[model samples]
Target: MRKYLFIFKAELMSALQYVANILLHMITYFIVIIIFFYLWNYIYDDPTQLINGYSKTQMIWYVIITEIIWNIVSGRKLCRRICDDVKSGNIAYNMNKPYNYIGYILSSHLGEGIIKSLIYITFGIILGRVFLGAFPTLNVLSIVLVILSLILAVVIDTLFIIFIGLFSLYIEDANPLFWLYSKLILILGTMFPIEFFPEVIQKITTVSPIYVICYGPAKLFVDFNLNNALNIIAFQFIYLAVAFGLCGVLYAKGVKKLNVNGG
Candidate 1:
């Protein structure tokens, strides 16, 4: 456990060294918030109001929370790191290490994720205050649910990324696969809420883990309803279990096929 924590700390420190890059990434998302705000405002401009079930203020706040969760769930470099390590023969070194490789990778990611989430949430709240007049309501129960959902989002997202990373053992080129996965996230409502989707598409997205990561927490933070919030929490855990089971099978098989060039 200590060894893994050390690795996590190392990764976090390395990330901190690229202070400019981190600031740029955070600012890029702030731009995204502005883009969505304008886009949605135009769509909802009519006096009759095309969108129902949420006011403009609520919708903007929804986007803000989704962006915060996204900062944690997205931007993982696990798959790319795995591919690089495998290609460079560094995976051989990892195999001989005392720590479990998957645990080490996960811990490293968790550390970076914690830092990114804090930065994004702070910027997101400030952006909301200035641009959208958004503010979080104070409630202990709601805050607890938001935290729980955020943790589940990270776990489920990491499991999914690990599953994708395992493809490196089978596929000759993992870049194309990574590209496709990224595109899917954008189209499938990771950046924007799925309420923008058609009814049928919205129904489909509701079952996907990505929706749980972004939309579930966004809704809970804004509305703070107990019943639906609890339901989303339950679904997140179940999705996480399925993700872990799938990744376990893939990891077991991928290790057998791993090819290590010169030590």
Candidate 2:
């Protein structure tokens, strides 16, 4: 545990060193929020109007929360690093290390993301309030639940991405798979709420990773219903277990294959 914490600290410090680069990225994030702001504003010609059960404020805040969650956990480098390590045979060196490879990647990415997530959430709230002119109505308990859900969501996301990355042992490259996974999340989860889709599609998406990964936290924040919160939280835990198990299985198989290939 201490070893992982050390790795996390190292990665956090490394991210801080590149804070300037992250700030530049924030500019782009803000630009995106601005674009969505106008787009939503145009959609809600009347302030009292509701689209898919979301008022104009709720809808805009939904986008802000989803974007923040996406930026925070969208650790694309996890896949790239895994692919590179396998291609260069560098994973061989890490195989002898004390820490688990998947855990190391998760810790490092979480550490790297901490600073960026904080900055984005901070700016996201201000922008949402300034432009959208409202915030999610939340009490103490709901706020706690949302935070817990987000933490689990992050772990779930990391595990799935690691699973995809470990496929490099079979596919010889996993970028395309990551791209496809990302697109699915972006379109089904990030771009709009599940309610915006047809009834058939909505039911299917609720069972997908996107339900917990991108939609769960955002949905809870914007529309804090206790029943829905409990449901999303339940699914988040189930998906977390599934993702962790799949990652372990794939990684074990991939490592065995790597050894057999003598590479």
Candidate 3:
């Protein structure tokens, strides 16, 4: 446990050391916000008319929350680290360690996710306030429900990414899989609400974990209905369990098939 925490802290310190890199990322981040701002503004045409229960201000807040959740749940570092370790044959060291490799990876990933989400969410909220007058509408209980749903979203996303990363054990290049996963998330409402989808597609999306990851929580914040918020939380947990179960099986199989070369 202590070792995992140390590794997480070390990774965070390394990330912070590149101050210019962080600032560059922030710039790109703001560019995305601006692009979405104009895009949504154009889509609605009339900002006053509510579309699918979201006003322009609420829509901007939804984007902000979605961006934050997308960053946290995507596990970008985890995928890259797994690819690097596999390519460099450094994963052999992890295999020999007494600690569970999956758990160690998850903890480190969660640490990075926490830091990135905090930075982006804080910046986004401040930016939204300045430019869009966007703010969350949830009361105390709804806020609690949103938090729980977000945590479940993180768990489901982590499991899915871990499963995806395990493909490195079998394939020489997992980058394609990573790219496909990212594209799916982007297209499946991680960046926007599922309401943008056609009615048939939107119906399908209601059961997808991607919808729970961002859209559901964004809805909770924008609407603040207790019953619906509770339902979203429940659905998040259900998907979390399903994702984790599948990952457990995949991890077991992938570890057994791991080939450590030049060790």
Candidate 4:
């Protein structure tokens, strides 16, 4: 724990040095939310009309929250990093180190994302309030629940990224798989709420990362439902276990297959 804590702090400080990168990302974030704001507005000429059980305000806020989460917890970068590690022989070298390689990667990714999460979520809320008005009513418990769901969403998203990235051991590249996963989340959840989809797609999304990763936190933030929050968090834990186990199995097998430097 202490060793990984050091790695976490080291990565956090390294990420802090890249302030310009954060600024550039925020610029894109601004453009994205603005685009969606207008698109949704045009879709709902009558702001009061409910499309698939979401009011205009609810729908707009849903997009905002989900986009924020998606950007902060980007799985593509994690997948790429893992692939690079494998290709560059870093994964093999790290295996000889005292620390667990997967733990190191996980800690580093979370640490880097912490600052971005703050900046994005802060600016995201400001943007939402400015353009769409205040968020839906919520008490202290609801706020705590939303925050918890968001954290769960991040961890689960990261685990899935690690799971896909582990395929780097057997495949030439795992990034294409990540591409598919990210695009699914983007079209199915980030750009629009799940309710916007047809009934069949909606049912299918529940099993995919779209439900626990994107829609869960956004839905709770927009419309706090205790039962739904509990259910989402529950599913998140299940995915968490599945992803973690897969990563562990693949990492163990990969290590056994390592032939680094005439080992």
Best by lDDT: 2
lDDT of 1 at 197: 80
lDDT of 2 at 255: 89
Give all candidates' CA lDDT scores: 0.76, 0.87, 0.76, 0.86
Model 1, span 168-241: residue lDDT tens: 77774465676776566666755556777888988888998767777788878776788988899999989988
- Report the lDDT of model 1 for residue 58: 72
Candidate 3 Cα outliers beyond 4 Å, as residue runs: 1-20
Candidate 4 regions off by >4 Å?
261-263
The root-mean-square deviation over C-alpha atoms between each candidate and the true structure, in angstroms, is: 2.4, 1.8, 2.3, 1.7
Cα lDDT of model 4 by residue, 72-108, tens digit: 8878889999988887777877787899888888888
Residue 117 in model 3: lDDT: 66
Runs of candidate 2 with Cα error greater than 4 angstroms are 259-263
Candidate 3 lDDT = 0.76
> How much is 53 displaced in model 1, in angstroms?
1.5
For candidate 3, the 10 contiguous residues with the lowest summed lDDT are 15-24
Per-candidate count of clashing residue pairs (backbone under 3 Å): 0, 0, 0, 0
Model 1 deviation from the true structure expressed as Cα RMSD, one decimal place: 2.4
